[model samples]
Target: MVTPRLIVFTDRRQAARPLDEVVNRAIDGGARVFVLREDDLPAAERAELAARLGAMVAGAGGRLVLEEGPELRKCHGLADLVGAAEDGVDLATLSPIYPTRSKPGYGPPLGLAGLGRMALAVSIPVYALGGVDSPARVRDCLDQGAAGVAVMGAVMRADDPARFVKELLTA
Candidate 1:
């Protein structure tokens, strides 16, 4: 089994680089999933990126999470996921949930108890995102019922991104 490794949340801020390179690096970094959260891009751009990313992740035997926008309500299985994030995603996530480089004044993090409630409410597996900065937080989320943690800065800003991911996988 893959041991449910880390997921990577790639947003519009990262669109400047070529999608192939970005996804390739993430795959090499032991990321088992990728959630494309590029809200600023037009539908065409988003779909284009999604198609490319989906191919890459699927080729590597990983899943690609595409935020369905308000369309999530229109989708069959995404409602629960949408609900969890609205509730206590961080709590569900274990520690810092948002990315460290996120815009200042992001909402407060949801601790373990809060996330546990979300886990109870939702059917699909939940992965903690946002300011996840430590290995301990990763362990905590797993213990608290999150499927895994998704990182942005922790891996993106590192010197050896793939190696950093390996460390995270082992951690």
Candidate 2:
């Protein structure tokens, strides 16, 4: 849809370093879309972080999407898919398309068929999220009709985020 081939999800708790530091590295590594998923922060704090991240992403000619907001560009889990278009969402991420330790307990994995089903159901671009850690998985998701893939641990925990992102983008 929007042509963002790779979206990096941020979780403060799961990060190995400061969120900004990790995100900056990712941006340098070719990540074009970033989703702020820190739900535990107070509203004001979250907004502040979003503003900061927005600036960073913009500097890299990328985009930033908040997990919670009235923003036109947004990311959503499968359960939130029903009214995404009505809510004015430009992009949505239907998650757990495969089993993932990064987002355990959300529900069962959607698999390829379910991913395709949801992708076809929504007019907005649907990104496959969860357990999409490899280049092959990225290709698989794209083949299944996903506009792209959203990842957490794959890039966040990587020793070389730039290289990891480059591999994903090239794949």
Candidate 3:
């Protein structure tokens, strides 16, 4: 099966613009994978949002993943990687690969070597997350054996999300 190389993470709290607008723009600009990381929303609201986003993503020939909530199909977070693997998750994100302002207090950044080790340790595809705002960073993650790179602030805060996503995909 094909895996997305560029994944956009959504956090309503960190968004400078409307979340849906940013997401739609990114999708239009070729972002094929998205992780709904809005942990602040109530369960019902979150599920509703996920359903809506899931439909949108599917219509665009993409995939939507949920950050650790009720969704048992996929998982996100470095600590959950092992459990996710054991639960048969095919694609997982191991985050904070680099220092990121988006996720404060998550812990110290895991450098390239750490990322490489985690990627090697996992049997499933590992997408690097955190501080991935540029093409070079994306390349670095790929070089370190990551299946892809996931980002939040980079696209969500862009003045032109579509253009940003286009540039990111090219990178």
Candidate 4:
């Protein structure tokens, strides 16, 4: 099974442009993986958005994973990762690999060392999420054994989302 090298999480509220516009530009820039994290919206609304984005991503040889989707499971720490792995999840995200504003008080920020340990502990593909806002950081995550780097505010808030994504993927 193939694993994404860069997974972008969407937060429409954080996007400087329309969600579809940003996603389209990212796709044009070679982004192939995305995650929909719009739990604040109504279920029907979220589902509709997911379906629309799924088609767009699919057209670009990519995929969109919904936060509440059953196909993939997301986890925070090693223990959760272990349990998710046992459940045969398609993939998982292990987060707060660094201090992040998005998750100000989610928990103590899990440093790179913690990320490494968690990545090794999980049998499934574990994506490094949170505070991966730069190319160097993205590379750090990969070096630490993450299957990919999952980002949210980076692309969402970038004035040039496409360029940022290209840089992140190449990094």
Using TM-score as the measure, which candidate wins?
4
| Candidate 4 Cα lDDT to native | 0.87
Superposition TM-score, candidate 2 onto the true structure? 0.87
Taken over the whole model, the C-alpha lDDT of each candidate is 0.61, 0.82, 0.80, 0.87
TM-score of each: 0.69, 0.87, 0.86, 0.95
Prediction 3 global C-alpha lDDT: 0.80
lDDT tens readout by residue for model 1, 1-171: 243658776753543455566667768977776667786888898789889889888999997766553312111123445565565342223334433555334445566665656555665556666666578777776677777776776665555666767777776
Q: Rank the candidates by TM-score, best first.
A: 4, 2, 3, 1
Where model 4 places Cα greater than 4 Å from the true spot, the runs are none
On lDDT, the leading prediction is 4
Clashing residue pair totals per candidate (backbone < 3 A): 9, 0, 0, 0
**Deviation in angstroms for 57 in model 1?**
1.5
Which residue pairs collide in model 3, if any?
Answer: none
The residue-by-residue lDDT of candidate 3 on 1-171, one tens digit each, is: 368888798987767688888888899999988889888889899889999889988899988877663332333444587787777776777778888888866777787887888787878788888898888888889999988888888888888888988887787
Worst 10 residues of 1 by lDDT: 69-78
**Pairing residues by index, what is the TM-score of model 1?**
0.69
